[model samples]
Target: MPRYLISFEKDAMDHIREEDFPEVTKAASAVCQEAEDAGVFVFSDGLSYDDGDVEHAVVAVDGMVTDGPYPESKELIGGIFVVDVPTREAALEWAAKVAVACRCAQDVRKFRGPAGV
Candidate 1:
């Protein structure tokens, strides 16, 4: 089986409202459960809003640490799922399910295996 990353992309701050978030969260969790039942789910998690809350770190040549969100972008990786599937087509199907569940766009990509068999 191959591992694939199903990433959900969207403007993190747009859809999250304090009042509506709970319902949305419940729905998302239900979808996750469905994936788990399907035996293709390995792991899944959602990221926090792209506010300054994220602790960013950068490594310098001398191993010094610098901080901040790498660069700014219009969209942020809101969530991701690591799934084990037999083929790319399977991964895409899983991504579609996630997209519909999250009510957002999902990007699926097969993960590269470790160097040298």
Candidate 2:
């Protein structure tokens, strides 16, 4: 089986409202359950923006540690899921379900491991 990553992209400033989040969460949970039943879901989770209490540190060229997102942008990865599936088609189906649940653009890509020397 191959592992695939399904990522949601959204603007941090234009965050989803708390009231609307539950519905999305419910939908996502349902999809996750479906995947689990099919024995494909490995893990899934939503993430907060990389700001405030989300401590981040960056090392500069001179070995100076800086704090914050590097080259910050309006959009950030909001959530993701890692699933083990037998084929790309299966992974794509999962991604479609996730997109409908999250109500956002979902990017699906095959995860890579360490390069063979």
**What are the lDDT scores of the predictions, listed in order?**
0.77, 0.80
True-structure lDDT of candidate 1: 0.77
Model 1 clash tally, residue pairs: 0
Q: Tell me the deviation in Å of residue 98 in model 2.
A: 0.4
List where candidate 2 sits over 4 angstroms from the true fold. 12-18, 59-64, 72-75, 114-117
Estimate the TM-score of every prediction: 0.78, 0.78
Question: Which pairs of residues collide in model 2?
Answer: none
Report the C-alpha lDDT of model 2 over 1-117, residue by residue, as the tens digit.
889998877452146687988898899999999999999989998665544744556677999877655665555666888899988898999999988888776788997755782
lDDT per residue as tens, model 1, 1-117? 899999977464366677877777787788778878988779999876556754646566899776754455455677898889999998888888777667677888888877785
